[model samples]
Target: MPRRGGPPEVNAGSMADIAFLLLIFFLVTTTIETDAGLDRMLPPIEPPDQDVVIKQKNIFTVNINKNGQLLVEEELLDLRDLRARAVEFLDNGGDGTCNYCRGGKDASSSDNPTKAIISLKNDRETKYATYITVQNELVGAYNELRNREAQRLYGRNFTEMEAEFLNPETPASIRDDLKDKVKAVQDLFPQKLSEAETSASN
Candidate 1:
Protein backbone atom coordinates (compact mmCIF):
# COMPACT_ATOMS: atom_id res chain seq x y z
CA MET A 1 0.00 0.00 0.00
CA PRO A 2 1.12 3.47 -0.78
CA ARG A 3 2.51 5.21 2.26
CA ARG A 4 -0.26 7.14 4.01
CA GLY A 5 0.14 10.82 3.50
CA GLY A 6 1.50 12.52 6.57
CA PRO A 7 -1.01 14.54 8.48
CA PRO A 8 -1.47 17.81 6.68
CA GLU A 9 0.88 20.41 8.16
CA VAL A 10 -0.94 23.12 10.07
CA ASN A 11 -0.06 26.73 9.18
CA ALA A 12 1.16 28.78 12.18
CA GLY A 13 2.49 31.77 10.22
CA SER A 14 -0.64 33.98 10.69
CA MET A 15 -0.92 33.63 14.50
CA ALA A 16 1.34 36.53 15.30
CA ASP A 17 -0.50 38.78 12.82
CA ILE A 18 -3.84 37.83 14.36
CA ALA A 19 -2.54 38.67 17.83
CA PHE A 20 -1.18 42.00 16.60
CA LEU A 21 -4.54 42.88 15.04
CA LEU A 22 -6.34 42.09 18.30
CA LEU A 23 -3.91 44.22 20.28
CA ILE A 24 -4.45 47.12 17.88
CA PHE A 25 -8.22 46.77 18.09
CA PHE A 26 -8.18 46.80 21.87
CA LEU A 27 -5.78 49.74 21.94
CA VAL A 28 -8.01 51.75 19.64
CA THR A 29 -11.29 50.95 21.38
CA THR A 30 -10.25 51.01 25.04
CA THR A 31 -11.21 54.00 27.20
CA ILE A 32 -9.22 55.28 30.14
CA GLU A 33 -10.80 56.70 33.33
CA THR A 34 -9.20 59.58 35.21
CA ASP A 35 -9.55 60.70 38.80
CA ALA A 36 -11.05 64.12 39.47
CA GLY A 37 -9.66 66.46 42.10
CA LEU A 38 -10.02 70.04 43.24
CA ASP A 39 -9.87 72.68 40.47
CA ARG A 40 -7.48 75.10 42.12
CA MET A 41 -4.90 77.39 40.58
CA LEU A 42 -1.91 77.89 42.81
CA PRO A 43 -0.63 81.38 43.24
CA PRO A 44 2.87 82.32 42.15
CA ILE A 45 5.34 82.26 45.00
CA GLU A 46 6.24 85.72 46.28
CA PRO A 47 8.71 86.68 48.96
CA PRO A 48 7.18 88.38 51.94
CA ASP A 49 8.36 92.01 52.21
CA GLN A 50 6.99 92.70 55.65
CA ASP A 51 4.58 91.40 58.24
CA VAL A 52 0.93 91.98 57.38
CA VAL A 53 -1.64 92.42 60.08
CA ILE A 54 -5.13 90.92 59.92
CA LYS A 55 -7.87 91.42 62.48
CA GLN A 56 -8.75 88.29 64.48
CA LYS A 57 -12.44 88.64 63.74
CA ASN A 58 -11.83 88.63 59.96
CA ILE A 59 -10.13 85.24 60.01
CA PHE A 60 -12.08 81.98 60.09
CA THR A 61 -9.85 79.16 61.30
CA VAL A 62 -10.45 75.53 60.35
CA ASN A 63 -8.16 72.84 61.66
CA ILE A 64 -8.21 69.14 60.81
CA ASN A 65 -6.39 66.38 62.63
CA LYS A 66 -5.21 63.01 61.32
CA ASN A 67 -8.32 61.37 62.74
CA GLY A 68 -10.49 63.60 60.51
CA GLN A 69 -11.70 65.59 63.46
CA LEU A 70 -12.57 69.18 62.70
CA LEU A 71 -11.79 72.11 64.98
CA VAL A 72 -13.36 75.25 63.65
CA GLU A 73 -12.74 78.51 65.46
CA GLU A 74 -11.23 76.57 68.35
CA GLU A 75 -14.36 74.42 68.81
CA LEU A 76 -14.88 70.82 67.68
CA LEU A 77 -17.47 70.84 64.92
CA ASP A 78 -19.30 68.37 62.70
CA LEU A 79 -18.71 68.42 58.95
CA ARG A 80 -22.36 69.08 58.06
CA ASP A 81 -22.44 72.35 60.00
CA LEU A 82 -19.27 73.76 58.44
CA ARG A 83 -20.91 75.49 55.51
CA ALA A 84 -23.49 77.37 57.53
CA ARG A 85 -20.87 78.50 59.99
CA ALA A 86 -18.62 79.68 57.18
CA VAL A 87 -21.49 81.60 55.61
CA GLU A 88 -22.35 83.27 58.89
CA PHE A 89 -18.74 84.26 59.45
CA LEU A 90 -18.18 85.65 55.97
CA ASP A 91 -21.46 87.51 55.68
CA ASN A 92 -21.53 88.99 59.13
CA GLY A 93 -21.16 92.54 57.70
CA GLY A 94 -19.83 93.83 60.99
CA ASP A 95 -18.41 96.96 59.40
CA GLY A 96 -21.70 98.03 57.78
CA THR A 97 -19.93 98.70 54.45
CA CYS A 98 -21.77 95.99 52.52
CA ASN A 99 -25.07 97.69 51.73
CA TYR A 100 -26.67 94.60 50.22
CA CYS A 101 -25.67 92.28 53.07
CA ARG A 102 -28.51 90.64 54.98
CA GLY A 103 -26.25 89.09 57.61
CA GLY A 104 -26.66 89.31 61.40
CA LYS A 105 -24.08 92.12 61.58
CA ASP A 106 -22.31 90.44 64.45
CA ALA A 107 -19.30 92.39 65.72
CA SER A 108 -17.39 89.26 66.58
CA SER A 109 -17.41 87.89 63.05
CA SER A 110 -15.87 89.25 59.85
CA ASP A 111 -15.68 92.97 59.48
CA ASN A 112 -16.57 92.90 55.77
CA PRO A 113 -16.60 90.54 52.84
CA THR A 114 -13.53 92.22 51.40
CA LYS A 115 -11.45 91.42 54.47
CA ALA A 116 -12.83 87.99 55.29
CA ILE A 117 -10.36 85.11 55.12
CA ILE A 118 -10.80 81.38 55.63
CA SER A 119 -7.61 79.84 56.99
CA LEU A 120 -7.36 76.06 56.71
CA LYS A 121 -4.70 74.04 58.49
CA ASN A 122 -4.44 70.26 58.43
CA ASP A 123 -2.32 67.70 60.21
CA ARG A 124 0.39 65.99 58.17
CA GLU A 125 -1.38 62.64 58.48
CA THR A 126 -4.88 63.91 57.82
CA LYS A 127 -7.12 62.03 55.41
CA TYR A 128 -7.29 63.62 51.98
CA ALA A 129 -11.01 63.00 51.69
CA THR A 130 -11.70 64.88 54.89
CA TYR A 131 -9.57 67.78 53.76
CA ILE A 132 -11.33 67.93 50.40
CA THR A 133 -14.74 67.84 52.05
CA VAL A 134 -13.83 70.71 54.33
CA GLN A 135 -12.62 72.73 51.34
CA ASN A 136 -15.86 72.00 49.48
CA GLU A 137 -17.98 73.20 52.38
CA LEU A 138 -16.04 76.44 52.63
CA VAL A 139 -16.31 77.07 48.91
CA GLY A 140 -20.00 76.20 48.99
CA ALA A 141 -20.51 78.92 51.53
CA TYR A 142 -19.05 81.47 49.11
CA ASN A 143 -21.22 80.12 46.31
CA GLU A 144 -24.33 80.43 48.42
CA LEU A 145 -23.67 84.06 49.20
CA ARG A 146 -22.79 84.84 45.58
CA ASN A 147 -25.96 83.20 44.34
CA ARG A 148 -28.03 85.21 46.77
CA GLU A 149 -26.40 88.44 45.68
CA ALA A 150 -26.74 87.58 41.98
CA GLN A 151 -30.45 86.91 42.39
CA ARG A 152 -30.99 90.16 44.23
CA LEU A 153 -29.00 92.25 41.77
CA TYR A 154 -29.80 90.71 38.35
CA GLY A 155 -32.78 88.45 39.02
CA ARG A 156 -30.62 85.50 37.92
CA ASN A 157 -28.43 82.96 39.64
CA PHE A 158 -24.67 83.53 39.75
CA THR A 159 -23.98 80.15 38.14
CA GLU A 160 -26.38 80.98 35.32
CA MET A 161 -24.62 84.26 34.69
CA GLU A 162 -21.23 82.50 34.63
CA ALA A 163 -22.55 79.82 32.24
CA GLU A 164 -23.83 82.44 29.83
CA PHE A 165 -20.62 84.41 30.05
CA LEU A 166 -18.56 81.32 29.18
CA ASN A 167 -20.82 80.05 26.38
CA PRO A 168 -18.99 80.39 23.06
CA GLU A 169 -22.09 80.88 20.93
CA THR A 170 -23.32 83.86 22.96
CA PRO A 171 -23.40 87.17 21.08
CA ALA A 172 -20.52 89.53 21.79
CA SER A 173 -22.67 92.26 23.31
CA ILE A 174 -24.60 89.86 25.50
CA ARG A 175 -21.44 88.05 26.54
CA ASP A 176 -19.86 91.33 27.55
CA ASP A 177 -22.89 92.20 29.62
CA LEU A 178 -22.73 88.78 31.27
CA LYS A 179 -19.03 89.24 31.88
CA ASP A 180 -19.68 92.43 33.82
CA LYS A 181 -22.43 90.81 35.83
CA VAL A 182 -20.26 87.82 36.67
CA LYS A 183 -17.40 90.08 37.71
CA ALA A 184 -19.78 92.08 39.86
CA VAL A 185 -20.90 88.94 41.62
CA GLN A 186 -17.31 87.80 42.13
CA ASP A 187 -16.39 91.20 43.53
CA LEU A 188 -19.20 90.96 46.03
CA PHE A 189 -17.94 87.63 47.38
CA PRO A 190 -14.31 87.18 46.46
CA GLN A 191 -12.78 83.89 47.54
CA LYS A 192 -9.93 84.44 50.02
CA LEU A 193 -8.92 81.06 51.36
CA SER A 194 -5.50 80.41 52.88
CA GLU A 195 -4.07 76.91 53.08
CA ALA A 196 -1.33 76.57 55.67
CA GLU A 197 1.44 74.01 56.09
CA THR A 198 0.36 70.75 57.66
CA SER A 199 1.18 70.65 61.36
CA ALA A 200 3.32 67.83 62.65
CA SER A 201 1.69 65.41 65.06
CA ASN A 202 3.09 65.26 68.60
Candidate 2:
Protein backbone atom coordinates (compact mmCIF):
# COMPACT_ATOMS: atom_id res chain seq x y z
CA MET A 1 0.00 0.00 0.00
CA PRO A 2 1.33 3.37 -1.02
CA ARG A 3 0.53 6.43 1.02
CA ARG A 4 1.19 10.05 0.07
CA GLY A 5 4.70 10.78 1.46
CA GLY A 6 5.35 8.59 4.56
CA PRO A 7 8.31 9.61 6.79
CA PRO A 8 10.42 6.40 6.82
CA GLU A 9 10.44 2.86 8.29
CA VAL A 10 12.35 2.42 11.60
CA ASN A 11 15.25 -0.07 11.22
CA ALA A 12 14.96 -3.25 13.39
CA GLY A 13 18.77 -3.91 13.46
CA SER A 14 19.32 -1.42 16.38
CA MET A 15 16.81 -3.39 18.53
CA ALA A 16 19.04 -6.47 18.42
CA ASP A 17 22.00 -4.35 19.64
CA ILE A 18 19.97 -3.06 22.63
CA ALA A 19 19.03 -6.66 23.66
CA PHE A 20 22.69 -7.84 23.44
CA LEU A 21 23.86 -4.95 25.65
CA LEU A 22 21.19 -5.86 28.27
CA LEU A 23 22.42 -9.49 28.30
CA ILE A 24 26.01 -8.34 28.95
CA PHE A 25 24.83 -6.07 31.78
CA PHE A 26 22.98 -8.90 33.53
CA LEU A 27 26.00 -11.24 33.19
CA VAL A 28 28.30 -8.64 34.70
CA THR A 29 25.96 -8.05 37.69
CA THR A 30 25.49 -11.78 38.57
CA THR A 31 27.26 -13.30 41.61
CA ILE A 32 28.01 -16.93 42.52
CA GLU A 33 27.96 -18.33 46.09
CA THR A 34 30.16 -21.09 47.58
CA ASP A 35 29.74 -23.55 50.42
CA ALA A 36 31.83 -23.24 53.60
CA GLY A 37 32.84 -25.84 56.19
CA LEU A 38 34.89 -26.24 59.32
CA ASP A 39 38.63 -26.64 58.78
CA ARG A 40 39.88 -29.63 60.83
CA MET A 41 43.18 -31.37 60.25
CA LEU A 42 42.78 -35.15 60.38
CA PRO A 43 45.22 -37.42 62.16
CA PRO A 44 47.77 -39.43 60.23
CA ILE A 45 46.96 -43.02 59.27
CA GLU A 46 48.54 -45.66 61.52
CA PRO A 47 48.99 -49.37 60.85
CA PRO A 48 47.54 -51.65 63.55
CA ASP A 49 50.18 -54.35 63.06
CA GLN A 50 52.15 -53.57 66.23
CA ASP A 51 50.96 -54.03 69.77
CA VAL A 52 52.44 -52.37 72.86
CA VAL A 53 51.57 -53.04 76.47
CA ILE A 54 50.59 -49.99 78.58
CA LYS A 55 50.82 -50.36 82.36
CA GLN A 56 47.66 -49.81 84.37
CA LYS A 57 49.20 -47.65 87.10
CA ASN A 58 50.72 -45.40 84.45
CA ILE A 59 47.35 -44.74 82.85
CA PHE A 60 45.13 -41.85 83.96
CA THR A 61 41.62 -42.69 82.91
CA VAL A 62 38.99 -40.06 82.16
CA ASN A 63 35.45 -41.28 81.66
CA ILE A 64 32.48 -39.27 80.48
CA ASN A 65 29.05 -40.75 81.07
CA LYS A 66 25.84 -40.16 79.16
CA ASN A 67 24.75 -37.81 81.96
CA GLY A 68 27.55 -35.42 80.97
CA GLN A 69 29.57 -36.34 84.07
CA LEU A 70 33.33 -36.61 84.27
CA LEU A 71 34.97 -39.42 86.26
CA VAL A 72 38.74 -39.08 86.31
CA GLU A 73 40.52 -42.13 87.75
CA GLU A 74 37.10 -43.41 88.80
CA GLU A 75 36.53 -40.35 91.02
CA LEU A 76 33.97 -37.80 89.87
CA LEU A 77 35.81 -34.55 89.21
CA ASP A 78 34.84 -30.98 88.48
CA LEU A 79 35.82 -29.43 85.14
CA ARG A 80 37.77 -26.61 86.83
CA ASP A 81 40.06 -29.04 88.68
CA LEU A 82 40.82 -31.37 85.76
CA ARG A 83 43.59 -29.20 84.27
CA ALA A 84 45.56 -28.90 87.48
CA ARG A 85 45.23 -32.61 88.17
CA ALA A 86 46.40 -33.42 84.64
CA VAL A 87 49.36 -31.11 85.08
CA GLU A 88 50.32 -32.82 88.30
CA PHE A 89 50.07 -36.25 86.73
CA LEU A 90 52.16 -35.32 83.70
CA ASP A 91 54.82 -33.54 85.74
CA ASN A 92 55.36 -36.48 88.07
CA GLY A 93 58.60 -38.44 87.42
CA GLY A 94 58.09 -41.46 89.65
CA ASP A 95 60.18 -44.10 87.87
CA GLY A 96 63.31 -41.94 87.35
CA THR A 97 62.53 -42.16 83.62
CA CYS A 98 61.79 -38.50 82.91
CA ASN A 99 64.63 -36.27 84.08
CA TYR A 100 62.76 -33.09 83.15
CA CYS A 101 59.52 -34.27 84.77
CA ARG A 102 58.63 -32.39 87.96
CA GLY A 103 55.72 -34.59 89.00
CA GLY A 104 55.25 -35.69 92.58
CA LYS A 105 56.35 -39.29 93.13
CA ASP A 106 52.94 -40.40 94.33
CA ALA A 107 53.22 -44.20 94.57
CA SER A 108 49.53 -44.56 93.73
CA SER A 109 49.69 -42.49 90.52
CA SER A 110 51.79 -42.52 87.35
CA ASP A 111 55.48 -43.44 87.63
CA ASN A 112 56.73 -40.84 85.13
CA PRO A 113 55.64 -38.51 82.40
CA THR A 114 56.91 -40.93 79.76
CA LYS A 115 54.80 -43.68 81.29
CA ALA A 116 51.81 -41.47 82.07
CA ILE A 117 49.00 -42.12 79.59
CA ILE A 118 45.83 -40.05 79.69
CA SER A 119 43.21 -42.56 78.56
CA LEU A 120 39.87 -41.00 77.72
CA LYS A 121 36.78 -43.20 77.48
CA ASN A 122 33.26 -42.12 76.66
CA ASP A 123 29.98 -43.96 76.34
CA ARG A 124 28.28 -43.92 72.96
CA GLU A 125 25.58 -41.64 74.36
CA THR A 126 27.96 -39.22 76.06
CA LYS A 127 27.48 -35.53 75.47
CA TYR A 128 29.77 -33.98 72.86
CA ALA A 129 30.30 -30.90 74.99
CA THR A 130 31.58 -32.93 77.92
CA TYR A 131 33.98 -34.88 75.73
CA ILE A 132 35.24 -31.71 74.01
CA THR A 133 35.76 -29.95 77.33
CA VAL A 134 37.75 -32.85 78.71
CA GLN A 135 39.80 -33.02 75.52
CA ASN A 136 40.49 -29.27 75.71
CA GLU A 137 41.68 -29.52 79.30
CA LEU A 138 43.99 -32.40 78.47
CA VAL A 139 45.43 -30.52 75.50
CA GLY A 140 45.83 -27.41 77.61
CA ALA A 141 47.84 -29.37 80.15
CA TYR A 142 50.22 -30.56 77.42
CA ASN A 143 50.54 -27.05 75.97
CA GLU A 144 51.28 -25.61 79.39
CA LEU A 145 54.19 -28.01 79.80
CA ARG A 146 55.44 -27.35 76.26
CA ASN A 147 55.31 -23.59 76.79
CA ARG A 148 57.32 -23.87 79.96
CA GLU A 149 59.95 -25.93 78.18
CA ALA A 150 60.02 -23.46 75.27
CA GLN A 151 60.59 -20.59 77.70
CA ARG A 152 63.44 -22.45 79.29
CA LEU A 153 65.09 -23.20 75.95
CA TYR A 154 64.14 -20.21 73.71
CA GLY A 155 63.49 -17.52 76.34
CA ARG A 156 60.07 -17.03 74.70
CA ASN A 157 56.56 -18.45 74.82
CA PHE A 158 55.79 -21.40 72.55
CA THR A 159 52.99 -19.51 70.80
CA GLU A 160 55.31 -16.60 69.94
CA MET A 161 57.90 -18.90 68.42
CA GLU A 162 55.18 -20.85 66.59
CA ALA A 163 53.67 -17.64 65.20
CA GLU A 164 57.02 -16.55 63.82
CA PHE A 165 57.54 -19.95 62.23
CA LEU A 166 54.11 -19.94 60.56
CA ASN A 167 53.96 -16.25 59.59
CA PRO A 168 54.09 -15.81 55.81
CA GLU A 169 55.99 -12.55 56.12
CA THR A 170 58.78 -14.08 58.21
CA PRO A 171 62.20 -14.53 56.64
CA ALA A 172 63.15 -18.06 55.61
CA SER A 173 66.17 -18.15 57.89
CA ILE A 174 64.19 -17.07 60.97
CA ARG A 175 61.29 -19.36 60.12
CA ASP A 176 63.62 -22.35 59.88
CA ASP A 177 65.07 -21.58 63.31
CA LEU A 178 61.57 -21.19 64.77
CA LYS A 179 60.55 -24.50 63.22
CA ASP A 180 63.27 -26.31 65.14
CA LYS A 181 62.32 -24.52 68.33
CA VAL A 182 58.68 -25.56 67.91
CA LYS A 183 59.72 -29.18 67.40
CA ALA A 184 61.88 -29.10 70.51
CA VAL A 185 58.95 -27.83 72.56
CA GLN A 186 56.61 -30.52 71.23
CA ASP A 187 59.18 -33.25 71.92
CA LEU A 188 59.51 -32.20 75.54
CA PHE A 189 55.76 -32.58 76.13
CA PRO A 190 54.66 -35.29 73.77
CA GLN A 191 50.89 -35.41 73.74
CA LYS A 192 49.70 -38.88 74.86
CA LEU A 193 45.96 -38.51 74.95
CA SER A 194 44.53 -41.91 74.05
CA GLU A 195 40.84 -42.29 73.31
CA ALA A 196 38.97 -45.56 74.03
CA GLU A 197 35.39 -46.72 73.70
CA THR A 198 33.44 -47.43 76.89
CA SER A 199 30.27 -49.13 78.09
CA ALA A 200 27.31 -47.08 79.28
CA SER A 201 28.00 -48.16 82.85
CA ASN A 202 31.28 -46.22 82.82
Candidate 3:
Protein backbone atom coordinates (compact mmCIF):
# COMPACT_ATOMS: atom_id res chain seq x y z
CA MET A 1 0.00 0.00 0.00
CA PRO A 2 1.41 3.34 -0.98
CA ARG A 3 0.96 5.45 2.14
CA ARG A 4 -0.02 9.02 1.24
CA GLY A 5 3.14 10.95 1.84
CA GLY A 6 2.50 13.79 4.20
CA PRO A 7 4.87 16.51 5.51
CA PRO A 8 6.06 15.64 8.96
CA GLU A 9 3.75 17.25 11.46
CA VAL A 10 5.42 20.17 13.20
CA ASN A 11 4.81 20.42 16.93
CA ALA A 12 3.02 23.70 17.52
CA GLY A 13 2.75 23.23 21.31
CA SER A 14 6.33 24.46 22.01
CA MET A 15 6.00 27.48 19.72
CA ALA A 16 3.89 29.35 22.23
CA ASP A 17 6.47 28.72 24.99
CA ILE A 18 9.29 29.88 22.73
CA ALA A 19 7.44 33.08 21.89
CA PHE A 20 6.74 33.75 25.54
CA LEU A 21 10.39 33.13 26.44
CA LEU A 22 11.53 35.55 23.76
CA LEU A 23 9.08 38.20 24.93
CA ILE A 24 10.24 37.85 28.51
CA PHE A 25 13.90 37.89 27.45
CA PHE A 26 13.41 41.12 25.54
CA LEU A 27 11.48 42.61 28.42
CA VAL A 28 14.27 41.83 30.82
CA THR A 29 17.07 43.01 28.55
CA THR A 30 15.43 46.12 27.13
CA THR A 31 15.86 49.50 28.81
CA ILE A 32 12.66 50.81 30.30
CA GLU A 33 11.78 54.46 29.80
CA THR A 34 11.37 56.45 32.99
CA ASP A 35 10.25 60.03 33.43
CA ALA A 36 12.92 62.53 34.38
CA GLY A 37 11.44 65.05 36.77
CA LEU A 38 12.58 68.37 38.17
CA ASP A 39 15.66 68.26 40.40
CA ARG A 40 14.87 69.75 43.78
CA MET A 41 15.79 69.16 47.39
CA LEU A 42 12.85 68.13 49.60
CA PRO A 43 12.62 68.64 53.31
CA PRO A 44 12.95 65.62 55.55
CA ILE A 45 9.77 63.82 56.58
CA GLU A 46 11.00 62.67 59.97
CA PRO A 47 10.54 65.02 62.85
CA PRO A 48 13.69 66.35 64.43
CA ASP A 49 14.57 65.02 67.84
CA GLN A 50 15.43 68.44 69.18
CA ASP A 51 13.20 71.49 68.90
CA VAL A 52 14.75 74.30 66.89
CA VAL A 53 13.45 77.85 66.89
CA ILE A 54 14.04 79.89 63.74
CA LYS A 55 14.48 83.59 64.43
CA GLN A 56 12.70 86.05 62.15
CA LYS A 57 15.07 89.00 62.62
CA ASN A 58 16.94 88.20 59.43
CA ILE A 59 13.91 87.00 57.53
CA PHE A 60 13.02 89.03 54.39
CA THR A 61 9.57 88.88 52.89
CA VAL A 62 8.76 89.23 49.20
CA ASN A 63 5.19 89.14 47.98
CA ILE A 64 3.79 88.95 44.47
CA ASN A 65 0.25 89.06 43.14
CA LYS A 66 -1.48 87.86 39.98
CA ASN A 67 -0.76 91.26 38.42
CA GLY A 68 3.03 90.78 38.93
CA GLN A 69 3.14 93.45 41.61
CA LEU A 70 6.08 93.13 44.05
CA LEU A 71 6.23 93.96 47.74
CA VAL A 72 9.07 93.94 50.22
CA GLU A 73 8.25 94.13 53.91
CA GLU A 74 4.82 95.63 53.14
CA GLU A 75 6.44 98.28 50.90
CA LEU A 76 5.93 98.17 47.15
CA LEU A 77 9.26 97.88 45.35
CA ASP A 78 10.27 97.83 41.73
CA LEU A 79 11.70 94.66 40.25
CA ARG A 80 14.88 96.57 39.36
CA ASP A 81 15.58 97.24 43.04
CA LEU A 82 14.84 93.71 44.30
CA ARG A 83 18.46 92.63 44.49
CA ALA A 84 19.62 95.86 46.08
CA ARG A 85 17.00 95.70 48.82
CA ALA A 86 17.77 92.06 49.59
CA VAL A 87 21.44 92.95 49.90
CA GLU A 88 20.57 95.94 52.02
CA PHE A 89 18.42 93.89 54.37
CA LEU A 90 21.21 91.37 54.77
CA ASP A 91 23.80 94.14 55.18
CA ASN A 92 21.84 96.04 57.81
CA GLY A 93 23.49 96.76 61.19
CA GLY A 94 26.94 96.04 59.90
CA ASP A 95 29.54 95.50 62.62
CA GLY A 96 31.54 92.92 60.64
CA THR A 97 31.01 90.49 63.56
CA CYS A 98 27.55 89.05 62.86
CA ASN A 99 27.04 86.36 60.26
CA TYR A 100 24.16 88.29 58.70
CA CYS A 101 26.09 91.56 58.91
CA ARG A 102 27.32 93.31 55.77
CA GLY A 103 29.17 96.53 54.80
CA GLY A 104 32.65 95.75 56.02
CA LYS A 105 36.02 94.60 54.67
CA ASP A 106 35.72 91.16 56.29
CA ALA A 107 34.83 88.34 53.92
CA SER A 108 33.17 85.91 56.34
CA SER A 109 30.83 88.58 57.69
CA SER A 110 29.05 88.93 54.35
CA ASP A 111 29.33 85.30 53.33
CA ASN A 112 26.20 83.46 54.50
CA PRO A 113 23.77 86.41 54.97
CA THR A 114 21.61 84.64 57.56
CA LYS A 115 18.14 83.22 56.83
CA ALA A 116 15.72 84.89 54.40
CA ILE A 117 12.12 83.83 53.88
CA ILE A 118 10.42 84.74 50.60
CA SER A 119 6.64 84.68 50.87
CA LEU A 120 5.14 84.00 47.44
CA LYS A 121 1.41 84.44 47.15
CA ASN A 122 -0.60 84.47 43.99
CA ASP A 123 -4.22 84.27 43.03
CA ARG A 124 -5.64 81.18 41.35
CA GLU A 125 -5.71 83.05 38.06
CA THR A 126 -2.07 84.11 38.19
CA LYS A 127 -0.06 83.42 35.09
CA TYR A 128 2.90 81.06 35.24
CA ALA A 129 5.15 83.69 33.64
CA THR A 130 4.62 86.11 36.50
CA TYR A 131 5.56 83.45 39.04
CA ILE A 132 8.64 82.50 37.06
CA THR A 133 9.73 86.12 36.74
CA VAL A 134 9.51 86.58 40.48
CA GLN A 135 11.51 83.40 40.96
CA ASN A 136 14.17 84.64 38.52
CA GLU A 137 14.51 87.88 40.43
CA LEU A 138 14.97 85.98 43.68
CA VAL A 139 17.67 83.85 42.06
CA GLY A 140 19.34 87.00 40.76
CA ALA A 141 19.50 88.30 44.30
CA TYR A 142 21.21 85.10 45.37
CA ASN A 143 23.75 85.37 42.56
CA GLU A 144 24.60 88.92 43.48
CA LEU A 145 25.16 87.85 47.05
CA ARG A 146 27.39 85.00 45.87
CA ASN A 147 29.46 87.32 43.69
CA ARG A 148 29.87 89.77 46.51
CA GLU A 149 30.98 86.98 48.85
CA ALA A 150 33.48 85.68 46.33
CA GLN A 151 34.94 89.15 45.91
CA ARG A 152 35.28 89.50 49.67
CA LEU A 153 36.90 86.07 49.96
CA TYR A 154 39.55 86.61 47.27
CA GLY A 155 40.32 90.03 48.82
CA ARG A 156 39.69 91.66 45.44
CA ASN A 157 36.85 92.25 43.02
CA PHE A 158 35.68 89.31 40.93
CA THR A 159 37.86 89.31 37.85
CA GLU A 160 37.13 87.47 34.65
CA MET A 161 39.51 84.74 35.74
CA GLU A 162 37.87 84.45 39.15
CA ALA A 163 34.46 84.16 37.52
CA GLU A 164 35.78 81.39 35.32
CA PHE A 165 37.36 79.75 38.34
CA LEU A 166 33.97 79.62 40.02
CA ASN A 167 32.77 77.42 37.21
CA PRO A 168 31.89 73.81 38.12
CA GLU A 169 34.59 72.58 35.72
CA THR A 170 37.16 73.79 38.21
CA PRO A 171 38.84 71.42 40.69
CA ALA A 172 36.44 69.36 42.78
CA SER A 173 37.70 70.91 46.01
CA ILE A 174 37.25 74.42 44.71
CA ARG A 175 33.92 73.61 43.14
CA ASP A 176 32.70 71.99 46.31
CA ASP A 177 33.76 75.03 48.29
CA LEU A 178 31.86 77.35 45.98
CA LYS A 179 28.90 74.96 45.96
CA ASP A 180 28.82 75.00 49.76
CA LYS A 181 28.93 78.77 49.78
CA VAL A 182 26.04 78.97 47.33
CA LYS A 183 24.08 76.30 49.16
CA ALA A 184 24.50 78.19 52.41
CA VAL A 185 22.96 81.26 50.89
CA GLN A 186 20.33 79.35 48.92
CA ASP A 187 19.16 77.43 51.95
CA LEU A 188 18.58 80.68 53.78
CA PHE A 189 15.91 81.65 51.26
CA PRO A 190 12.70 79.65 51.57
CA GLN A 191 10.63 78.84 48.51
CA LYS A 192 7.30 79.79 50.03
CA LEU A 193 6.96 83.29 51.40
CA SER A 194 4.49 83.11 54.35
CA GLU A 195 3.36 86.67 54.75
CA ALA A 196 1.16 86.85 51.66
CA GLU A 197 -0.83 90.06 51.47
CA THR A 198 -4.46 90.04 50.37
CA SER A 199 -5.72 92.64 47.89
CA ALA A 200 -8.41 93.87 50.27
CA SER A 201 -7.99 97.52 51.18
CA ASN A 202 -7.10 98.02 54.84
Give all candidates' CA lDDT scores.
Answer: 0.92, 0.82, 0.58
Predicted structure 1: lDDT: 0.92
Candidate 2 vs candidate 3: which has greater lDDT?
A: 2
Report the error of model 1 at residue 98, Å: 2.1
| Model 1 agreement with the true structure over 10-78: per-residue lDDT tens digits | 899999999999999999999999765987758689977998889999999999999999999999999
List candidate 1 stretches off by more than 4 Å. Answer: 1-10, 41-51
In model 1, the worst 10-residue window by lDDT is 34-43
Residue range 14-71, candidate 3, lDDT tens digits:
9999999999999999998975443245778999999966555445677776667777
Positional deviation of residue 178's Cα in model 3 after best superposition, in angstroms? 5.6
Task: Quote model 1's TM-score.
Answer: 0.85
After superposition, which runs of candidate 3 have C-alpha atoms over 4 Å from their true positions? 1-39, 93-100, 103-112, 155-202
lDDT of 1 at 3: 81
User: lDDT tens digits, residues 1-202, model 2?
Assistant: 8676977878998999999999999999999886443223466898777888877888888888888788988899998999999999888877777788777777777787767799988888987677777788888898788888888887898877877888999999998888888988877776788888677663
Candidate 2 stretches with Cα past 4 Å from truth are: 1-51, 198-202
**What are the per-model numbers of colliding residue pairs?**
0, 3, 3
lDDT of 3 at 44: 80
> Which numbered prediction scores highest in TM-score against the true structure?
1
